[model samples]
Target: MSQPKARRSQLISTYGIGGLFPSSTTSYMIAGLHEWKEDRAEPLSEPRLARSLKVVALKQPPAGGRKDVPVIRFPYTQVCPSCRRIGRLHELSKDWNIAECSKDKQPLNPFRLILACRRGHIDEFPYFQWLHRGQGKAGSDHLMKLEARGRTSSLADLVLTCTCGVENRNLDGAIGPLADFGTCRGSRPWLGPETEACEEIPRVLQRGASNVWYPAVRSSISIPPYSEALSKFVDRHWPLLADREVVTPALLARVAELSDGKYSVDQIVAELDRRRGEEQEEDDLSEARLRSGEYSALIEGRDEEDIDADFVCLPRDVPADFDRLITDVRKVTRLREVRALYGFSRLEGAGGSESNLCPLAPTHTNWLPAIQVIGEGIFMAFDRDELARWADKSFAKDRARMLKVAADRNAEEYGHAPKHIDIVEVAIHTLAHVIIDQLSLDAGYPAAALRERLYVDDNMAGLLIYTASSDSAGSLGGVAAMAETDRLGNALAEGLVRLSWCSSDPVCIESKGAGSDALNLAACHACVLVPETSCEKSNSFLDRALLFGTRDGGNESEGIFSHFVASAVGA
Candidate 1:
C-alpha cells in the first residue's frame, strides 16, 4: 500500500503473491483468473495452473527451493572517460554480477544513466544515439569512450567520444523534451522475447530506484463451491461443454444425448436452474449477497469435512459485550481464493484502464499466470440490529460524511472512488486491523501472511481474517486456532486494549484526517495500519477513535467497544 522506494523487479522474488518464483521476479504479467478455469484437453492428468494458462513462456517452478531462483543482478555500465567508450562491464567477466570494467588495461567507472518514460517504458541509456547521432562515420565496430570533465558530478561535465575522433555531444540536455532516445523501441526484456508498442519519450532514472516498477494485483474468494454437484461435473468436463451455444432445455437434452450416458439431462437442467437462480439473486437488490458469498455462509451453512470446506460455525461463550454486539462467530477452516495479475503501471499511480487484458496476439490465449492458495480463517458477523441502530446516530452519520467527501475527492483524482463502506464497516475494518496486529504477536504468524477479507453491504456486515499462501498446502493452524472461544475472547480484549491507547496517542487519536491520501481520520502507522497484503482497502477508511474515542473530549461512551473496555476494567 505504501509505495516505498526500492528495486521493484528484484524484490518480487521475495514478496510477490506467487512467492519468489522465477517468472514473478522479471515479468510484468502474471496469470489471470479466467485462465484457471478447467482446461482438460491438454492431456495432462494433474493441472499446471501457472504455465499452461499464461500467454508467454511457461513459468516453470524452480527445480530447488529459494536456492533455485537466480540472484537478481545487472552488469555495470562501463564508460571510458578519456576516449568516450561505453559498454557493459559484463564484456570483461563471465558473470554480470561480479564483472568489472577494463579498457586498454585501465579500469573504467560505471555510468549513472538509465532511460524510462511516463508510460512505464524503461530501457538502457541510448549511448548509440548520444555518440553517433545518425552519422555515417561511426560503424558497429567503433570503440566508444566517455569522459567527465569536472569534480561536480553534472551531466554537462560528461563527454562522449568514439575511435573515429568525431566531436560528440556532452550528456547535457540529453533528458529534456527535445533530447533524443528516439521513439521507444517498446522492448519488454522481462517477458523474455515479448515486446510492446509505446510512443512515450524516454526519461532518465537511476538504476535500482523504487519508481522503476510497480505491480497491479486483484484477488477474490471462492464461495460455496458452485452450489451443485452437476455444475461441478460440467465445469470439469469443459471439453464437452465448450461448444454448447446456450443453456436452454433443448440444448441440455441434446448435450445429454451426445454425452452417451456420461451425464443426465435432468441433472444438467437442475444445475442450470441453480445457476440462474443465483444470478437472479445477485440482481435482486433487496437480497444482494456480499462479496464472495460470505454472508450466505455466515448466516446459514455448515462446515465441510476437508480443508476446502465452505463454512463451519462453532458456538462459543461470548463476553458480555460481544454478546450484545456480535451475532455469530464462524471458524472457516478452509477457503479458496483466486488472484489475477492484469497489467502494470510505472511512475504514475497504479490505476490502469480495465481493458488492458485484451489479447496481445491474433489468436486467443487461454493462459495467464495464476496460483491457488488454501487457507483457514475466522468470520465474525456483527448484530444487524445493533449496527443498524448505530448507523442512525448523528455522530456516525457525520463520520460517514467525512469519509464520503474524502472518497469523492479521491475518485476525481484516481478515476474511481474506493467502494464506499459505511460507519459500521469502518468500525469492523478498524477492529480487524487491531485484531491482526495483536494476532501477529500471539498467533505465531507474520502480519504479511494474515490477510483481511471484509464483508459489508446493506444486508450484511462482517470481517474475515485468514492466512493464505501460494504454496499448494496452505498455512498451519496458527491463525485459525485463535478462533477458540476462550482464545478469541482474550484476543479480542487484548486487541481492544491496544487500540484504546496507541503509542502515538493524543496525536494519533486526535487527528481528524491522516495517512497517504488523507483518507484516514485517526489511524497511523504507529497503530492502525498493517501490511498492504493484509488489508483490502490499502489501509484506508480506518479510525481508532470509532472503536475507542476522539482525543479532544471523547470517551468510552462515544465508541462501539465501550462496553468491552468497561467490562475488561471491571474484571
Candidate 2:
C-alpha cells in the first residue's frame, strides 16, 4: 500500500540527503492549538470514514469575506503535504478549485485548506514538508524516508468523522468535521497522513488518530432532540452568540446546563426575558439592522431610566413546535404587562406631554389642528367599531382622563376651550358599545406587541405662556392688558373647537376706528365668537368693549344691533 499521508501534526524536525534540513515545528504549535469540533448535525457528505480534515493556505489573503462585520467564511487556497499541489477543492462539484490560505500562522500557512475538503484526497500540489529526525544504517538517516511498499495512490473520494461517531463523506467543503472514534482505532481506517514514525526510537510521530477540526464537547446552546442539521446550526451560532451582549453567554450556558443535554424553546425564551430588563444586558455583536432614526439607545440593554418601550427580547432557539411555544409564552408573559416603547417623541420637540400644545408659547397659543390630528390618529387606531372589547381595559379605566388631557391640550393650542364633541370623542363613542373578546388574540398577531412597556416623558407638562394683547391704547399697561385678554380667547377656541383663529386685537385697526368701529363680527359654529361674555349683558364695560369686535358693521344698525340682541336675549 502507498504510505499513508502524515496525520496533521507539527513536524518536530527535518533531514535531507547531505545531512538534514533545519527544524521548523513551532513554539505555539508545540504548545498545541485549541481543538474545534465539526458541526455533525449538518448532513454528512460521506458516511464511511471516521476522519476528514480542513486545511488552509496562509500565503494568500482572504478574497473579500474578512471585513468589519464578523462572518465565518471558507477560504479558497492552501498548502498541503506530499506535493506542491494546492489542496484543490471542487465545491458543489464545480470544477476543482484552489483552497484559500491566510498569512497569520506560517507553519499552518496552509491554514484550514484540507480541513475544508471533506473528501480525504489531497489535491494535486506540492506540500511544504514539515520534517523530523530519522536514523539510517550508517549512523544517521540523511533524508526523509518514502515507504510505498506495493500499493499505489488511489483516486477514491475522502471521508471524515463527526461528533456523533458518524463517518461521512466530506465532499464539497474545505472544513472537515470532528466525530467520536470507535475503539480509538477499531473502526475501518481511512487513508490519511502517516501517524507512525520510527516507533523504535523517540516515538517521533504521534501514536494514533486525533479528534481534529473542532473538539466535541460544547455544553451550551443546543436545539433539543437533535437532528444533524439543526445541531450544526446551533453549534455554529452558539459560540458567536456567546459574545453577544443582549444574548448573554451565561444565559446560554444556563440553558446548556439546565437541559442536561437538550434545551426546549420555552426555557430559552424565559431566560431571555429575565435578562432583558437588566442593566447589564449584552449588545448584539452582529449588525442586525433596525428602523431608520432608531438610535443606539439600548447599548447595555437599559434605557436611561432603566427600561425601554421598544422590541421585546426573546430566546434564540429554533423549536420545531413553535406553535406550542407560543402558547407557553402567552402564559409566561402577561398581556397586561405589555407596553409599546416611546422613542417617537424624540422627534416631537414638545417632549412627551399633551399639556403643552405650543412648544413656542404654551399658555396663549392654541394648536388645535395638531390636537385634531392626534385625535384622528387615536380614533383610527383605537376607536374602531369592534374595538372596546379588545381595548386594554386598564387604559379604558382612564379613558375619560385621556380625553380630558387631549381637550386641555387642544384648548391651549387653538386659543379656544375644547368641548366633549371632538374627533376623539366621536371615536371612543363608537367604541362604547363593543364587547371585549379575549379569543381574538389566539390568531397570530400581525402587529408588533407594544404593550409590554410604555412611558411618558416628564419634561412636557408645564406652560410657557406667550401672550400678545392690547391693554389700553391710551398707555402701554392698557395695551398689555388688552393683549392678554385677546390671548385668553385664542386658548379657549383651541381647547374647544380645534381651530386656529387670527388675533382679534382691535389695535390692528386705525386710530380713527379705535373705540367701536374697529370691532368686527366673526361667525363661529352658528355663534358669534369674540371675547367671552354674556349675550344680553352688554351692560358691563368689558362686555361692551369685547362685543365691539363682533357687531355687524357700518350702521345705525351697529347701535340697533346690540339693543336688538339684548332685547331678543331677554325675550
Error of 1 at 145 (Å): 5.3
- For each candidate, what is the lDDT? 0.59, 0.20
Query: Can you give the TM-score per candidate against the true fold?
Result: 0.67, 0.15
- Model 1, residue 192: what's the lDDT? 34
Model 1 ranges with Cα > 4 A deviation: 1-120, 123-212, 227-234, 244-292, 305-318, 348-364, 392-394, 401-421, 471-474
Per-residue CA lDDT of candidate 2, range 34-114, in tens?
111112112211100101111110011112221211111122233333322233233211333222222222221222222
Estimate candidate 1's alpha-carbon lDDT, on a 0 to 1 scale: 0.59
Q: Write the per-residue lDDT of candidate 1 for residues 1-571, one digit (tens) a residue.
A: 1112222222232223211122211222222222222232122111112222333211222222322322222213555444446776676434454433343544444556666655555466777567777676744566666766777777787778777756776887765442454676664433334557878666676554554555555445555544223444554444444443644667677767765786798877665556456545544422123353556765564555434343344444555557788777777666655453434555444443333223322244544333346687787888867888977877677778887878777767755445464888898999999989988988888888888988876777888888777543256877778877788888898888767887897888777678866789889988989998788777888988788766455454678887678667778
Stretches off by above 4 angstroms in model 2 are 1-137, 152-210, 215-571
